[model samples]
Structures are given as C-alpha cells and as structure tokens.
Target: MGDPTAEANRGLAVGPFAHDGVWLRCALHCHTTQSDGMLSPAMLRRYYSMGHFDVLAITDHDQLTPAPDAHSEDDDLLLLPGTEISLRSPESGGPLHVLGLGVNAMPRVPERATLLETAAAVQAEGGLAFVAHPWWTGLRSDELGDLAGVTGIEVYNAGCEVEQGRGDSAQYWDTLLSQGLPMLAIATDDHHYPGFDAFQGWTMVRAATRTPEAVLAALAAGHAYSSNGPDIHGIWIEADRIRVASSPAVAISLLGAPPRGVRVNAGPHGLKQPGDVPRGADGRRNGAYPGNLLTEATFPLLTGSPYLRVEVLDAHGRKAWSNPIWLPARG
Candidate 1:
C-alpha cells in the first residue's frame, strides 16, 4: 500500500502554495452528490477557486467520492475523492459516519457495518479515516478505540456549532488530549450551500500544494494549523512547550486560562495563548472558548503539559478552528 503522508507531500511542487515554504489551505470535508449536498462538484470547484481555497474533498454520504471528475480546474484549484461511509449503530442502527480521504477506490462498509469493520476497510485503503460529528450524532468521538489504524477526529464542526459561530466538536478532542492521544483536531463546514459558507472551518496545512495528498500529509505528520479565519502560518512546539503564530500584523490572545494561561505573541498571525480547556456549565463548550481574535496576546510556553494546540478565529467570529500543535506522543 502507498503511504498517505508521502503521497500528500509529493504534490507540493505544483503551485505558489509551494512558493517559499508557505502552508497551503484547504477544506478536508464537505459533501456533494455521490450523496446529499445541494452544490454539485462543479459549482463547489468554481467557488473554491474564487474563494482562494487550494483543495477540497467531496465526502458524500454512503458513497465513494471522485467529486464529479467533471469540474474543470481554473488554475489553482483541486478536487479530491473521498466518501463518508455511513456506519450504523448496532443499538438502534442509526448513522455513524466515517470520512475517508485520498483513497483510490471504495472498500465496502455495509450500512450496517460496525464502526470497527468500516474503519478497517478505510485503513486498508491507505486513507485517513476520521470519526466525524460524533457529538451531533449522539455518539462519542472516542469510540474509535474499538478499531485500529484510525487517524484524526473532528473536534469541531462549524455546521453543528451554529450558536455563536464556533463548533462544540473540539471539546471531544480536547478531552481525548487530556488523556494523551495524537488525535488530530479539525474544523469542518459540513457545508451544503454557497449560503452555508459559515460552516467552512478548516486547517492551513504545511504542504506543497492543495491536493488530497498534501492535506493528508500535513494532517498525519502534525504539520497542520487550524483556522476559522486569520491564517495560522506556522507553530512552535517543544515537548510540553507550545507557541502559535499567525499571519504577520495580527493580534493574538489565549482564552479560558485559570489553571491555564492565554498568551499572545507576534509572528505568524501575530499572537499565541494557552488556556485550561474549559467545560461548559452543562459541561459542553457551545461557545468559542479561549476567546476569539487569535492575534492578540503575549504568552509563555508550558514545557511540562502533555498536550497543546491553538484556536484561530476571525474578528467577525464567522470562521475559526483549533489544530493540534503539540501532543506528548507526537511532540
């Protein structure tokens, strides 16, 4: 089988996204027909190019994605194949969807297939399979433990986080980090419309170009930074140590620091912060924690903590995300 990280990195030679070590940006998950999305792959490709997105995956429901091999590339845009295998719960047989990116063909995961069986097929394909939107689906994201060779978890889903423009999904991953797993956190739009751009949370990956391979490589090797807006240019990590930066000339602040501290600095996106992961009153962070305006703070790196990452949000609170920057195992 091919290495997903190596495949993802090879495409770096393709564009300006490759110019001078800048990270390429992309949306890893989204839908189209091959399943139930309002926008066709062609329409999505048009919008992605105009919006300056480097790449995207069309992970349709219960079907494999080649995303309409029909859309013409207008220059810097790329469409990758993916599929959201709709695994059903054994208890009530409800949906337990898993996303498979960068696969060459579909491996069968019957609708009634257990999550573990489905994940096996996905891993077998040499693709990265993530448990998507578990909080929304009434399942815990951590349930992937029953399976082997799983990668990534949607800690936040912007579409599910409709309240104050932040997704509750990150909490699930944060909880996992507290226990020390290299659970790659991400923000997804799960978008279905041009109108639903609000769901478009993503990661700025250190990749050669915006391709399925680049995104996966950035994701696997822990080289990605997340964002709703205000790009996360690069990150600094050392053991329990952590430092985050964004596009130059921006302010940075860390939010929710009591046992935790929020710090800010200048460089990429111009800021950084650290905070004790907050638990909501009902024990759910339905709001943007660690505060918004990622480019506004001065902070220190905690060299003993077992985990760390930064949340990047735009000033409007419209788009944002958290990417895992440090994990005890991976760091």
Candidate 2:
C-alpha cells in the first residue's frame, strides 16, 4: 500500500487499498446450523451482533445457506454468501477444505472428477475459491493445482496448528506469484463450533468501505492480510515505500515491520481479561491481563525501501499478519 489516500488520487483503482474511515470488518469464513454447526443462521447473527462483526459469510458444507434469507436480526452487519467443500473424502486420501468467497449463485459440479473438480465448480459459479488447510495433517494432496482459475489460497487457518496453503497450497501459490499470477492469500477460522469462533485465524483486508463490494474488491486485488489478531487499515504503497495505520485502541508493534526493523507501541488491550473472562478465538485464558491489548499502531515509511510486510501480535501471543507489500520496484 503507499497511502490509500494518495493512491486514491492517482486513480489507479488497483489493490484493496481504502481509507474512508469506519473500521472495515469482515469474517470470510463461518458455518451455520444448516450443516454440522451448533446454531442456525438466525442464532449465528446473535453471536456476531454481540461480538460486533461488520460482515459475515455463512459457508456450510457443500451448500450456500442463502444469507439474508436466514436473517433474524436487523443490524448494520452485512451477510455475505459462501460454502465449503472437502475436495476429497476421508476414504480417498484427500480432505482439504475449499471455501467459496462471495458466491453470487450456487454452482453445481457435473460429476465428481476429484477434489480438483470441486474447486473448479465454485469458480464456475462466479465465486472465488481457496484451498483450506491444504497441508492440514491427513488432508494433504499432490493435486494442489488440479483446480483451474482459482483466486487464491488460505495461507493461515486458526483452526489448524500447522495446516493449510502455507504448506502445500502455498508452494502452489508461490509458484503462481513468482510468475506474476496475481493470486490471493487468505486466513480463516473454518470455525466448527461457536466456542472456537476466534480460534485459529483470520485476514484483515484494506478496503474503501465495509461494504460487500469492498470485500470482493479487496480479496480480488490481494489487498489483504492474515492474522490470529490485529486490524490493519490505510495500507499504501508507492515509490519504494509502504506505510500503515492500525486501530487507535490497541497498542501495536511490528514484531518485524517490513524492511527488517520492528516498531512497538504501548496501549490498553481491546477485550476483557481477568475474572471469568470468556476467550475469543484462541483457547488460552485472558489471564490477569487488563483486556485485549489489540490497540492500534502506526508506522511511517522510514527506511525508504521498496517492499515489506506488517505483523501485529497481541499480549497473549495471538497476532495479525499482512500480505507482503511491494513498494514500487522502480520509482
């Protein structure tokens, strides 16, 4: 990113860069009672409402749950459409999860050619597809590139200790990226239970607004980052330099900011910590800490380098990650 505002004036219309204010929020992967989940879409809204998520995608097993159709609450939260597919079954030596992002209409497969076909079907439906947990333990497969016209891969998943595109799917993505394939990387929770809501991971996308259009644009342009925690905003890239600003609340630091240096800021956490505090996402107890120390942090383009990434870690070890930022290679 350089300065979303600066790029905004250049009129390039590239990247998911955006800066117009409200915290852009979205949870790209979620399941409903329509599948193996414990609650219905209606109940799920309650959870999002209480947690204050801006948008959500209800991805059930092999099906689109027709969000807004399942709406029971009247809030500003946007309900995005989606679904999940286990490319191969437990019996066939394949079990990777593929998520369909921003599906406009449900697409069906002609026949079960294999996991490759599963991913292709989603793309055919005018939706973007991703390999979930590509290296998810027993779900590994050599058919990583079997699917055609894929949009991206899940580099990190909160539900897995060390699974997903980062392993196999990532190698495939890297091969594609090295060739300037313009592929995207995403983070998801693949949340099966409500208790595991924040467990695993998520992605922070830079968008012009918190609208559905912005979500699709961000994911499409690869202007996104993954994380267990942290929020990134106003990512701008220009003239061999990248700058970023996170929320104003949490104290954030670049455990390793781009260009190989680190930036740290001290502030209060975002959520409750002590007492019978219920954890969000991670299984660890908040402990005696005050609250979620996810306060925002900002770093300027200090090194005048061409490219780098950002990572924000919470006091509890949970953290958020941004995709690599390639400042203009030749300014």
Candidate 3:
C-alpha cells in the first residue's frame, strides 16, 4: 500500500473509509450550558446519543466543557474535549470563531485575540483547529488564507442556517482549494438550542476504532466527509478517473474553481433548464440543479490539474462533501 499520510494529504484515501475501518457518525461541533447553549453537558450527551451519533465534541464558546465521564463509560459513545474561540478579524470587522477539537486542555486565550494567535494556542495544546463558519463570521474567503495552523473549516454550519440562513460555506472551500490550500471542510450542527439546530449537520469519519484518538486521527488525515443528510459510502480515485457511491443523490459534482468543475445528473428530467429545478418547502431548489436522483457517478480528470473535490446533492436538498484532492499543476 502507498503511504497513508501521503494519500490523506492528497485528500484521496481509497477503500480506507469502507474496508479499513468502520464509519463513525460524529457531532464534532456543538454547544452547551458551559457557554450560551440551552442544554447542559449531560443533556447534550443524551440528545446526541439518541440521534445515533457515535462521537461528540462539546465546543462551547471560549470554554471547554468535556462530556460527563459517565457518558463515555458506556461503549456506545465516545466524547472528545473541544471548545470554540473567538478572535477579531479586521477584514470582516467582526469576530471569527475557531473550533478546537480533541483538545487535551483549553488553550490560553487573551482577553482580545487574533485568529492566528488563537489557532496557534490551540494547536500548541495538541488540538485540531477548524475555522468555524467563515460565512457566518462575515469573513471573505481570502481572509482565511492569512490564518495558519487550522486543519479545516465548517463548510456548513446548521445553527447559522436556522438563525440567519448564512450557513452553507461550500464556496469558501472551493476558493481555498483554488488558492492551492490543502484544507479540509466539515459540516456541523454548532448547536446552541437543544432541538432546533440538533442533527441538522454532522461529520462522518472513517477510523480503525471508535476511540477519540482514532476519530481525531481520521479527521487530521482527511479520512472523512461531511453532510447535512446525504451519506457517501465510498470514493474511488485513480490517476485520471474517479468514482463515487452515495445515497440517492440528484447530482454528483466534481468541483474546483470556475472552468475546472463538472457534474452528472440522473433521472427522467434529462438536464432541465436551470430555472426548471423544482423548489423545496424552503423555496430553495431541491437536489442539485438539472437533476432529480442518482446514487453513483464517475468522472475523468485531465492530468496535471490543480484540485478537485466531490459533492453529492440529494433529492431533499441535503449534500455530502469530500475534502479536496490536490493535483499537480499543468506543466
């Protein structure tokens, strides 16, 4: 087998997520009474456990509220320490939040903080840091390029969606990929209220075991995908070909910056006009544009490209996204 680290860095881990280990449904970001959330740690545990989440990280604002020890004593659930940090960003003229997951202890944050400072502190404490909802934070995509030491970002923040409808940050991930950044993206509930924002988003990680270390290691290794509802069962990548298997998706897209992306659609619609896509109860287009439902797709990538990632949009307007796989630039 090739080097696992190298394959992970390329964002194309083959068969590992399916055959190498089991898939762990994880709520990697959420909140509780340790900060502004309505639920206490114990209640949060009960909620997610009932939701069928195998792993949880209670990322309260500016504070680390580890799950109750009793919660982890059972074999069904694993809890990891986490917190969210806020820092001022001049670009957005607002605060940017970063989620520090798998933390051993809370980072030392100043009364006033910057993104780089806070991220460094978190990493120094042996945590994995992810920029939390750049769109929700009023940040432009370029603003994130200045920050370092972050593993990835919250591509979809469910709380931001329910509250202000500013959640889906898929464009930001594409922007970073176009800039040649090897960043990963995840979907999260970022739940504050108990039932309102719960279970709307989650990360699906592939690990050898259900322990915190394995989950965190999978996250750090990009052996994961994020979704609102759709599930990606497998991704197969070769030198110039790619194949994806997922829940009944309306469209499977291989996306990069403009001029670098393509998609395939399934159903009797036969590629409807962009305007013909049906609207959902939310008034947004259901599934992806020009398609109705699909469960698998394959695409070809020319050699010596920049980067590409996979996105699957289900009939219910939910989506699953894989971390981007970088390619060598054309000579």
What is candidate 1's lDDT per residue for 1-331, written digit by digit as tens? 1112222322222111223344666677787644677777777666666677777777888677555553544556666677888776555445677888776788677555776777778877777788887677766544544645567777667676663444566666666666656667666777666676433677666665545676677666656555665654334332333334443222344332124435342222322224423221000111232433333222345444465455544445543444444433332
**Per-model root-mean-square deviation over C-alphas:** 9.2, 9.2, 6.8
- Per-model lDDT: 0.56, 0.57, 0.77
Q: Order of all candidates by TM-score, from best down to worst?
A: 3, 1, 2
Say which candidate scores most in lDDT.
3
Stretches of candidate 1 off by over 4 Å are 1-22, 69-73, 89-94, 141-144, 163-166, 209-211, 237-242, 247-298, 318-322, 327-331
For candidate 2, report its TM-score. 0.66
List the candidate 3 regions with Cα displacement exceeding 4 Å: 1-19, 71-75, 268-292, 302-305
How far does residue 65 in candidate 1 sit from its true spot (Å)?
3.3
In terms of lDDT, model 2 sits at 0.57
Per-residue lDDT of model 2, residues 249-318, tens digit only: 2344332222234454333232233322211111122223454343323344444334345555655555
Superposition error at 101 for model 1 (Å):
0.7
TM-score of each: 0.72, 0.66, 0.85
For 1-331, candidate 3 gives per-residue lDDT tens digits of 1222233433354534534777888998888888898988888888888888989999988887766755544547789899988777757668788899988899998776766778788888889989998888888776654567879999999999999998899887777767777788889999988779999999988888878999988998888889999887666675566666677777778776656666766665334543332221001123654444665566676344477788888878888898877666744
Query: Which residue pairs in candidate 3 have backbone atoms (N, alpha carbon, C) closer than 3 angstroms, thus clashing?
Result: 249-294
- Model 3 scores a C-alpha lDDT of 0.77
Comparing 1 with 3 on lDDT, the higher-scoring candidate is 3
